[model samples]
Target: MRRLFPVTDQTAAAETTEGAPGGGDREWSLAELAAAYAYPEPEPEPEPEPDHGPGGGGPGVWLRANMVSTLDGAAQHDGRSQPISSAADMRIFGTLRALADVVVVGAETVRQEGYRPARARAEFAAARQAAGQGPVPAIAVVSAGLGLDFSLPLFTSPLVPTLVLTGAAAPADRVAAAERAGARVVVAGDGPGVDPARAVAALATLGHRRLLTEGGPRLLGQFVAAGVLDELCLTVSPLLTAGDAQRIAGGPSVAVPRRFELASLLEEEGFLFSRYRRV
Candidate 1:
């Protein structure tokens, strides 16, 4: 893959080899990818303000959403994102997961995508250990109804215990069912629906500061609306699927659209991977 934005001296040198067989378009190793997408180093902690509680912002807490969309603004094709993605996209996806402490995903996405446990990648084992992280990142599912199949491997066999983020008003029986399946239930909102900011804070309280969300539109919309999203890693596909499909985010429109500045952009086989930070 080739980087297209914020060109560094190293990337510039690689660009000089363009047009040769397997030159600039050569696949990147996991190490290179890791360096390209590494999270910012933790900053010094500040004194806690009076009356602050869990979910209150703190140092090292970053929430980034990873999503894919077509050139015509379709987040998914035929109720799934796989059809609209590429090999390089999957590489970046795995890289993002490897770097995160927890992956926050919406319930519908978990079901639709055949969610599985986040496996420990051998490539990142050393890095993760040095960062004081567990063998693998935890999977945190956001749900209001808690309508999930507890029999799935995602709940039954995670390397790290899975988390269910819901509100206080969720059904008691479902909460019990989740716990029975050995999943940890976290209350992140007062009402039945999850409060996006609270969910981030809840994860933060659990020591998952490097957060990544593989959103399924509505969930991403909630995070965007709550103004808690710190960064976005969006993959722009070259193909266009002109169907009535969900955008990268779905929900009530903000009175003002949020502005984001590009942090990095990479390209491979017509796919554009772009990372943006809130401006």
Candidate 2:
């Protein structure tokens, strides 16, 4: 996996970042982002408050989803997002992973994108260790049938063992297969598919509150319908693909429109990276 470090908005405008891995070649700035989403300041004598769960002090869960779309609102061109993405987008993507405790993804995306385990990055090591996080955030794949390849490195060799979130009715043999393949099987839903709320609660029980979901449309749809999504980090690619690619939120039509307030927007290589908080 490639590494990415954020540059400030001011610096991005002035000069491209050196040692940058393509994208805008350092034109994208995340400095203002660093300020907007500032990490919690240290407390001299921290108090052990009650387990408020999700937010740890606020409401239910602190769910955030990250996604990218083209100018025409197409998330994928040929069943993949890479064709519509840029290097700057990848920097934000990696940064998001570094900051989260767990990354929730859908099974289809895992297969299509050839998912891999999240490895520890030297750039974010000190920050993570200081925040009491592991070397790398865990990967949680939401699946109904546990259809993922057991032998894949994503399940077999992860810095943190990959979590398979499934429903009670998933195939018994498949569930056993996943466990045998060195994966942690978590039954979070009661029906054929994983329940979004139950999944979040299950993760919360395991002390994973800094949640980030990289959706593949269907999974995102479930989260939105559950009304548990707290934030959305969207990257708008400059290209336009008029094909029938799915929208950013591709799933069943949500009746109630969930609104989010713009937190910040950064630009580089004609890409617009925007963070929106649920309002």
TM-score of each: 0.94, 0.83
Give the Å error, residue 177, model 2: 0.6
Q: Itemize residue pairs with steric clashes in candidate 2.
A: 17-26, 23-87
List model 2 lDDT by residue over 222-266, tens digit each.
999889998888888999889788887767777878888876666
lDDT of predicted model 1 = 0.92
lDDT of 2: 0.80
Tens digits of per-residue lDDT, candidate 1, 1-279, equal 888888767667778876422227779888888888888887876766778854433667889899999999999998999999999999999999999999999999999999999988999999999989999999999999999999899999899999999999999999999999999999999999899989998999999999999998999999999999989999999988998999999999998899999999989999999999999
What C-alpha root-mean-square deviation, in Å, does candidate 1 show against the real structure? 3.0
Clashes of each: 1, 2
Off by over 4 Å in 1: 18-23, 47-57
lDDT over C-alpha atoms for residue 249 of model 2: 78
Q: Worst 10-residue stretch by lDDT in candidate 1?
A: 17-26
